[model samples]
Target chain A: MDNQTISPRQFMFLVILFSVGSSILIVPTPLAANAKQDAWISISISVAIGLLLVVLYNHIATLMKGQTFVQATIAVFGNWFGRVLLFFYLSFLYILASLVLRNIGDFMTTQIIPETPLQFTHILFLIVVIWGAYLGLEAIGRSSEMFMPWVVLLVFFFTITLSPQIKMENLQPVLGNGIVPVVDTSTFVIGTPLLEMVTFLMIIPYVKDGKTKKRAWILGTFIGGAILTLITLLCILILGSDLTALNTYPSYKLAQKINIAGFLEGLEIIIAIIWMITIFFKMVVLYYSTTVGIAQFLTMEDHRPLLLPLGMGMVVLSIIAYPDVAYFETFINETWFPFAITHGLIIPLIVWIGLLFKSKKQNKTQQEPS
Target chain B: MWSMISIIVLALGIFLLEFPKLYKKNRKKEAWFFTIFLLSFTIISVLESLEVELPNPLDLIQTFYKMIGF
Candidate 1:
């Protein structure tokens, strides 16, 4: 009878697809550049952070039982304060959604459809987001379910196809630049993408198998991180750390580099399709989540009606928000990690701690019978 | 501007589509807030599409990050 229940396997699929979305496209190169061939080291460090977030998300979810993170906020903060906190959360989510849309739009223009107007792809992407949202959470869930196999299959193909080009010599003297740069890059690498799991709190309460949620989140993150680590490792081997960081889509480039005795060339186009599909799933998740969050914040029963305009708005916002790719690059490097941490990590931690104390106090009160 | 026409169309379309769901006595205050919130996004989207000058609130914030060197 519980409508909100989502199986752990389904949740895992969502996590993997969602986790790989934008991060896979842009993160590998710079992270490799930053830490040299030891980029996987940074990924490992970031993945540890992902594990921490699993604990945090599970802690909050278990406390709230079957309610979403939004409901839990009210439980923690009461109506007025909870509502206010929710507004902030909603705003952050909205920004994240818009940023993702922008990133995907820019990526599209640069790579996939250079001649097509950015607005066209951005708007089309948002249309998919609206369609997903309008069809309801169940549609979003099912779509992720359907996309999971393709996403996973393509990832393996992408990795294996690039195998011939991989040069073990490229990985010589791993951590060649000393641990300092690795550590510095680790903060962003681990902090930004892995740190993003804090948003899972929003989905936590809606997750069934509450006891197994921690396991689901941890395993899911590890699976996603493993894919990323493999990709980064391959990127280093194929392109060398120097060349890897120069290209925007290193994995795509890796696919392009494949010739396989002239049997398989221009695999990058195929990889781009896979990348776009996974990215769309991720964007839709974020967009649906933001709409749901805002609807709940504003006390709306259905977020469906708001989806179209929000999607439309996001496409436009994507263009205006950053001056160009360089500015966008700078914002991500210099700006995003910290903001992501505060909103995605620290604030959620505060919510968890608040819930913990409140639960403890409630337990005490119940025991005392006062 | 063309953006104005687009914004009006979007806002009007949303108001029409959502009015039935939105204008109910059983509705929560948040429903009203979300409706308006969404409507405002339409305006923001239109102005942004038109390439209107909007404040970059993150400049100072980003500058600090650059200075700190992350």
Candidate 2:
């Protein structure tokens, strides 16, 4: 278990999949609602800011080299305070895993399989996630590597087929409402999938090559952000801002618009497939981190034993996490940004500053020649 | 009632599957931790199956942000 490692390529695939995860389905709607025709602009700006955030995360990873997020916190803050912080961080990861589970379950129930119980969808999904985590990171990495091309092919087909429907006039009077709305909409975009990339810190240490890891991290983010931006642009161009904002799953609807000579129609399932694949890897990564974080927290050797129980907890939490879609919407729009910021930005910044101070103290001690 | 029974049975099945592995290895601490987590979650699952009220965790974040005036 200790010797397990994933290649830089596999790491990149996981990052790409994680970035594109739930955002592919839901991001365009809110962006369109707030920024209108300039929603793509909002995402582009957020992607830029998200790049900087990734740089910050990379720096923290370098500073605490070879330590997982849990270990890094404990290393930086000392035992007691670190454990306290770890408690909050662990809960954050756990809640996030549950939320991601809930996201898919909700999507399945409302969009794809309306008659199925949410619990059934959640259980089936958790079984796969739990099994992936049980197999450990190496298997997860290999599987992601195998599945990467399919995700890319599906996304490419979805985009190319929808190209014919894009209306140039939908993006008329660019930034017409001024940059204010675009910037405002970007706040929501930055919180999700962007700040949420901070979770990748847990897996960064396990990537095999030290030199290429940073490159993989940044490139994966860039590609994922580009894919998301393309999808958002298509939604606005084809569906228009009003209709895009109206639909809960705009991209799913966008896929339904695929009509190649009126023969290749109803490829909406392509969107569903792409979303399910990305979200599965995303949840697996999160679930893996949560389980591994707990095992490390408990000073245990392996994380597999905790998988089933934690998964059961996740199923229950996923159901109760959002009473209905309305509350979930409010939470994502109103509350998620700040909550994500606390864990993603503020905590990492604190740890980075702490590392700097510690290193400076070490320099001072070395100069004293005692 | 059926939901409750199924939940309990599922919990027991999970326990049976996992506990023996820890027991065979003589990992007492690991076993204890596993039992605590499983038991707590099982109780929650049963409560959930019964349609009992369970606090949504995200509400904590929402409340915190509200207090901070976000």
Candidate 3:
């Protein structure tokens, strides 16, 4: 909105970081619980579904080039209804940012710093998120480029170092529980993490090149989804299905299991830092989208005026959102799936269809005039 | 007591950081909105610090999930 655009490469890295975000630590356990040894299958299915979603979002972006998702929604839906949809979109993104903030807070307080109050972690983290966003998307994009290599290297290190613990026996009897569980877990994967790429609809317009934009979305989704799949597979192979399912942060547990000589025993710190860095990128991107989306919805010329206040709102709402991680996980499993479908899939599909009709009508009008 | 103090201090810091830019740009409406937003958070923090019960929005969502048999 400020005439700032991120390069396609930065967009790709952002996608990779955002998709990996908390999922590295959060997704493995749930997938393990549902799909057991076949959790990787769930991830693969979600990746396929996620790629299609990227295509759908790219199609919509092509239809409404040179506009943020909010502007494009208004263009298609007209004023009042469009305004309503904009509010819905804003709520979706804001809730997402708040939930992610809550997640980092939960992770830190429960796992990393048990003595520290959750509020402290939320506030401390939001400070950076607000600052990164205040510098604008370019700064965020550039920062992601700076951090991506280190994050990737750390992940690879964890994976290779933990290779000794991976037992082929852990993946025995493939599809032992039948496809139901895999499908069920894949639904969770699709609804929660993958379809959450819908937020990128708000982001893709900022890519400077059209060709680069298309490739970035498609390639980024697959690469990101692939990373998640690998992580899930690693968790299953190393920790076994029961331990993977039992531990809340199975990937973190896998990190803990990296006992390559006694010297490298406690490497969860690297995993924590990796999660923090990726989550920071994800939260900032979502927070920036919410602020810009709201400012546009309100017809404000500058979004800066709203950044800090909305950040305050994010911190407070995060506190108000979940009583504890257990409830939070339950909400994800039960409520989040349908909610994601409505916002992520159904809403965007409706808008795209509306755009199609609008384009056809305009073409007909031009033909009649000619 | 500590939480309340911290909330006030944080709110003040936010005001200090952001208010000048708004004042410099003559953005009165934005200034008021920011102040109000900070004030509301302060109140919530104070209430939370005092251990007063407050309804959480996420609970409402959970209730909706139950109502839908989810």
Candidate 4:
């Protein structure tokens, strides 16, 4: 745990790893299902949604003027109510950890090791998260920093490998059914993976130089968003609209299709490993944030004690939140709209807006009589 | 069964690792809320995972993809 301040580039790399990890592998399959060949609309729409949330988060970050979410919560809302709102934030984080871990667990059983018991993989993932947290923020930061290049490079390779199989014509008719479906799917786009960027605020204050903080976070986010859009387009081009919809891991299938003189067959497993690695980092980041934020918000001296209960809680919640794969993905697509928007969009906006007024009033007073 | 025991034991060990900070005054409600929420969250996720049914969005997705041959 080197207390050395993080450069902006390191944080940006963390964002790239966090953003591309989960969204790249399987996000397009669901988006393709929702948007048809029109899944491109979902990614584009989610991009707007992601950016909108980023703007909200940025506004809150700016209003706090370098305060972490913990410090800002108390400053803007006062001690008690701030704590209440933070509880909600924590709950949202818990749900997020649950969902991501559960998704990872599902993927592991389905793709990585089919015979291994689901519970075993689930618990094993938790062990990594818990152990990782024990090592502290620097560990997560350093690991994300280290692994990001390989993750990004592997993704480009996957996308390029499927380049030939991608039938550009499969994406035709360009909004043929009209704006209604595209916009509807776009909301689905917003609700699913992209809006989760609200968690980035937790990491904002930790940026070593306050000057380049915004640029670093946005760099990470936009880069991640770009990767998502490209993968969605690639999946649509490769799998058409139907089978892409049918398969749970359509992006993996596209990578599998990259056969170079028949020797490159089954390379999508490489992509799946990429998915697993990147998502691992994403979960670690979110889980780490949850523990650290709670510890800080509660005024604890350290966050190490909270990791296990949090991990166990996530596993429990992931199982409880969605009944089956269809419902799991469904919860992600539809039901999560209000849930995500409330936490991801609505609450953050309120906190930021409220804090903005608070700062202005204080600034005005500071200039007046003193 | 053995794995579940390990998870619970590991979780408890992890919780105990932070025992010194648990007594701090500022973090009580937070500790309470987190403990309750985590417990509740886990129970619900485990129970829900056992139940079976497709959410409507998935069916719609499948149908739409099929209609478009996508």
Question: Which DockQ values do the candidates obtain, in the order shown?
Answer: 0.48, 0.91, 0.52, 0.17
Model 1 residue pairs with clashes = A46-A190, A298-B30, A298-B31, A299-B30, A299-B31
Ordered from best to worst lDDT, the candidate numbers read 2, 3, 1, 4
The list of candidate 2 runs beyond 4 A from truth reads: A363-370
Q: What is the C-alpha local distance difference test score of each model?
A: 0.75, 0.90, 0.85, 0.73
Error of 1 at A162 (Å): 1.7
lDDT of 2 by residue, A115-175 (tens): 9999999999999898898888999999998999999999888878878777999998898
Residue by residue across A1-370, what tens digits does model 3's lDDT show?
A: 7888899999999999989897776888888988899999989998898898888899998888678889988988999888887777778888888998988888887788999988778988998888998899899999999999999899889888988777998998999999998988898888767878888887888888898878987888888888888888998898899999899888888888878778767888989999999999999889888888887776666778678767767777888787767888888888888778878988899889988898889889999988
Interface RMSD values for all candidates: 2.9, 0.6, 2.2, 7.7
Docking class of 1: acceptable
In candidate 3 the C-alpha lDDT for residue A70 amounts to 92
- Compare the candidates by TM-score and give the number of the best one: 2
What value of lDDT does candidate 3 attain over all alpha carbons?
0.85
RMSD of each: 2.5, 1.3, 1.9, 5.7
Q: Which candidate leads in DockQ?
A: 2
Itemize residue pairs with steric clashes in candidate 3.
none
lDDT (Cα, tens digit) per residue for candidate 2, span B1-70: 9998998899899999999989999999999999999999999999998999998878878998999999
> How far off is residue A75 in model 2, in Å?
1.9
Recovered native contacts, candidate 2: 0.89
Once model 4 is optimally superposed onto the true structure by TM-score, how far is the C-alpha of residue A289 displaced, in angstroms?
1.1
* Cα-based lDDT at residue A50, candidate 2: 90
